[model samples]
Every structure is written in structure tokens, then in C-alpha cells.
Target: MKFFTGFLLSMVFLALASCDSGDDAGVPDKGYRYFPLAVGHYQIYDIVEITYTLRDPDTARYELRVETPDSFLNADGDSTYVVYRSKRLPGEVAWTYLDTWSARRTPEELVVQEENIPYVKLRFPPYNGQVWNGNAYNTGERDDYQLDSLGQGQTRGAQHFDDCLTVLQHDNEDFIVFLDQRKEVYAADIGLVYKETTQLSYCTQPGCLAQQLVEQGVIYKQWLKEYGKAE
Candidate 1:
């Protein structure tokens, strides 16, 4: 009788442990905090763009400020936030309107519409090595975007972020002809901290075929300079 009672108690404990494990597994991770979007939240970034040409490369420097000031329901009845972008040249005091974009978050993914094109920017429960189609809703060709270095600390300029993740949008390089690479980094509470895009066409002439000399293309880099909430 004593042995039977002990066995029964052990079985009950195991069953309860299984139930707890199942409940925990059913709850999805809240990785969307890495790309937080809230009304009145604003971020400023320093932009440096270099356009490569046959002659010397042309460089442009400016500052971009993006803010979320309003939210509205989309056609699907989902809440969408309006992102307003403004730019200011160096030594300027006023910002010039650049453009407007929209972003929405779903249970499984986050979508951003830029220039009327919807892009799946990030998938929920983001983990290292996770890949998804960035142009899933657009008519563009299939583009795989991957996440890496999740929960890592990153330092941008003098600002240091305790937690951050990187999304690699595209990486295609043919050393002899062309190269294309794009990536973005986001902090836990900040939307975007750093973005880089490199597109280059190398000289394929017989004399420069193996030299990998860039003939024309562009390199764009944006770094977060400030972030806060508007009154």
C-alpha cells in the first residue's frame, strides 16, 4: 500500500510538470520590442551618401528625422502608424518634408509600406538565422532577409545600446562584375539605429576584369544620432 501511494504521487507530479511546460511553450516570445513603434516617438539619424561615378565619387551629408505622430486603421481593420520623414542639411535649422510611410504590426510579422510598397520587415519571435521574404507583399522578386546577432550590444558613434539585432536584407557579390549588400540594425526600444546599402558595378573590361575596380554605384549609410518622444 505504501509503495502504491508513493508511485501515484510521483505520477501526479510529473503530470503537473508537463502541463506547466506545455503552457510555457504555447506562449510566443515578444521579440517585437526590438522594433517598437509608438506615437510621438522620434529618431534622428545622420546620413552620408556617396555616389560612385566614372570620375571622383560625389558625397552628400545630411540629417534625417523620422517621427510617428498619428495612427489609423488600415483597410483590413488593423492599426497602422504613419511615419513622417524630414531632412535637414548640415548647418540648417529647419527640416524639410521628405515623405510619408506607413507601418503595421501583426501577430506574426511587422510590415512597413514605403513608397506604396509593402515590405515584411521583421517576423515575430525573431531568432538568429531566421530568414523570411522581405518583398512578400510587393510585386518585386523574392528577396530573403535574415536576422543575426540578436540580443547583442552595439555602439553607434558615441551612443551605446545594450540590446540590438541586425537584419541582413540582401547580399550578392560577384567580385568581377557587381556587388550588392544591405543591412539594418535596430535596438530594443529604438526602431532603426544603423542602415547601410552598398551597390557597385565593377569594371569588367579585359584589362580590369580581375581588378574588381568599381565603375559606378552608390554607398549609403545612416547612423542614429538622437532619439526621444515629442511633446
Candidate 2:
């Protein structure tokens, strides 16, 4: 009888120890993850890629961002694009964005649309051209890039692109850093002002498509409650 009681007590102690060990192992390994921009929810998009060339005539500085399918000239004169964004929060950067590590990777060649990625679409005031595989003027190209540092532990993702504002110049005549203007919105009826240095728009081609709908009095305007400012 004494031996049996001792055996039972030992088993009970072992079981309790195993339960504690399991709990310690199950405290989820905390870390960041990457999700496409579409999964992010914000009233207004942080960046915008438009289909026009913004020129500073006074400073003789001009920046051209090709944002439509018409911008790329293929062997058959075709174009495609999509938006690859850096983060989901309006102004905050995420840890899982493709940045320094991606830039170090091998170059990627442009290809046709495939399953897996989401594309931004525009309806009203529609473009008189083909659909894009991703965002902006020229079709996707194989190149090298890094995420420009966003402040306070936020980092922009790296990308393959034609050009990004990698260098900062002191003179306003020398640079145009397209920035996200709104960190938060105060009121619905109030108007705002945006200086020349800062601008707000969607980041990728697909995001631009959504914005295009907003510009054209489409579904986005009725749904997303974000707005613009005075510049």
C-alpha cells in the first residue's frame, strides 16, 4: 500500500511539471510579420503615385513618375504595373517590409500577372489603356533599392525600381521628397495645408487605382472617409 501511494504521488508531480513546461514552451514566439498593403486599414493612403510629371519651373527641377500602363513601352508597346507598399498604418512603418535584405537579393525580371498578388483598380475617369501588373509609369523593372529610413524604428521596404529619393539635398531647388502628410485627421469639415516638401498619395499602382476611384467619384469616396489638404 505504501509503495502504491508513493508511485501515485510521483506520477502526479510529474504531470504537474509537464503541464508547466508545456505552458512555458507555448508562450508564442513574438515577432513581426509582413502583410500586403491591402490588408492594412487607414482612412487615407499615405503615398500617391500619379500619372503626371511635377515640374518646378522656377527651379528648373522636374520629377516624372510614370504611373499608368501607357508609361512602359514593351516590344509590342504594352505596359503593366501594381503597387508594392511599405507598411499598413497611415504613417507608421512595419518591421516585416522588404528592405535591406531584399535589395541584396538577385535581380528580378518583369513578367506577366500571376495569381497570389492583389492589384489596385481604378474605375471612373478610366485610363484608355491596358491594365497593370503593379504600380506607376514604366512597367516593372529589375533593379536594386533599399527602404528609406522612416523615423522611430519604422523602416520603408526595399524595392526594385527606376528611381527613389535616396539622396537628400539641402537646397529645395535640388530635391523633392514626397512625404505622407497626415498622421491623424482632426475633423471632417476642416481644411488643411500641405507645404511643397510634403505630399500625400497612395504608394503603389493598385493603391492608385483605388485612389483613382476616389478621384472619379467612385466607391472609395463613399467608403473610405479620408481626405486631402491645402498645398
Candidate 3:
């Protein structure tokens, strides 16, 4: 599933690259953004984490309800959503459904757009003079550079914009995600500006989150702890 999605996007991105009209970062947020209102019952309110119950906007209940998964690339690449329920209670359910109006965007769309992409790549801030490409990010390569700063790499970030970095991470099974990260350059060593980390959380099970069977019928999630540095 993931490979198909990426493959389709790569072709689309390749074609779109021909008409690169510079940056279109602050366009989406320019229009009216939607916020979930508690329908008519604006009087009552109880904020819970997205991973929690799906509340009902009308009845103000939170019981026996269907829920929509609100995932995002914040630390992990997933879905994002707005809870909708005409009524609520402990047992009320949230009626979750598929949302259309999809997008074919690069990671740079986070700041340019208005999505909540966490800025975790800023561990290494820029030092002296240079242009910081806050999109050319890498994985686990935090030590050699500077702690949190956009650490320097062997490659030049001159062309690492939008989702261009994905070209470097293409078809790799070990790589689960790639987010547009903020970057800057020091005297010689480059520093990080900010990165909207696209975290991929999954379980190693037959039908678990992003599970796949590498051998036989046994399914598994390709994951590893980020405790070491990137070689």
C-alpha cells in the first residue's frame, strides 16, 4: 500500500517538477480554515486528546460513538481529522467516514500551509551565514552535526526542497517516513532550523498498524528505535 502510494506520488511529483513556479507555501492557510464546533451546544465543552473519545457536537455526549482517526505526521506520519458528533455521552459514538479532497503535497507544505507539523528538526539551529533549507532533513544523524542543530551531511542542500529529499530515500524498506525539515548552514557545518518530524508508529502484528509479511504469512512492522546515529 505504502509503495503504491509513493510510486504514484513520485510520478506526479516528477511531472509537476517541470512547472516548478518557486514556492507556494502560504497559499492554503490563506483561505478559510475549518474548526470543529460543538454544533448548537456551544455552552458545554470538554477537551480531550484526539486519541481519546470522539465527542458528539449536538448532544454533547461521548459514549458508544464511532471515531475517526486523527493522525498526522507530527513525530509520525498518520491521519488528521476533526471530531463530529451531533450528540454526546460516555457511550455515544462518533460517525467516522472517509474524507475526500485529497492533496499531493511536499513536506514543506506544513509551515506554508496551516497544518500542525511539529518542528523537531530545530535541535541544531543555524550558526553564522548561509541559507537554511528547512526541508533537507535526515534521520538519526544528530551527533556528528550538532545536538538538535541541522547537522552537516556529505551532500549539499541546494536542491533539497519540498519533498525532493524523498528522491534520496526512495525504495528503501528500512525507511518508514520522510518529513520536510528546516535546515541552516554554519561556517562549514550545517545546522537544523526546524523539522516537522513524520513519525511512523506501528505494531508488529498480522493486521497491526502498517504491518507486512516479509517472510511467509507472518506479518510484521518494519520499525527500529532511534537510539543510534545515522551512518
Quick one: best TM-score, which candidate? 1
Q: Return whichever of 1 and 2 wins on TM-score.
A: 1
Q: Write the per-residue lDDT of candidate 3 for residues 1-231, one digit (tens) a residue.
A: 999999999999987885675565333431111111121211112222122112321222232121222324444453333322233445445433322221112332212111332222221122223223333332333322222322233222222212111111111233222212212221121111112122222334556434421221111111111111112
> Candidate 3, which ten residues in sequence have the lowest lDDT sum?
218-227
The best-first sequence of candidates by TM-score reads 1, 2, 3
Q: Give a tens-digit lDDT track for model 1, residues 1-231.
A: 999999999999998888778545767667878888889999999999999999999999999999999998878877899999999999999999999998999878999999899999899989999999999999999999999679999998778999998999999866778888999999997888999999999998898996979899999999999999999
> Which number leads on lDDT?
1
Local accuracy of candidate 2 as per-residue lDDT tens digits, 114-188: 234222221111122323323322344422222221111211222121211111111122112232221211111
Supply the global lDDT for candidate 1.
Answer: 0.92
Q: What's the CA error at residue 35 for candidate 2, in Å?
A: 4.9
TM-score of 3: 0.16
> CA RMSD for every model?
5.6, 19.2, 22.7
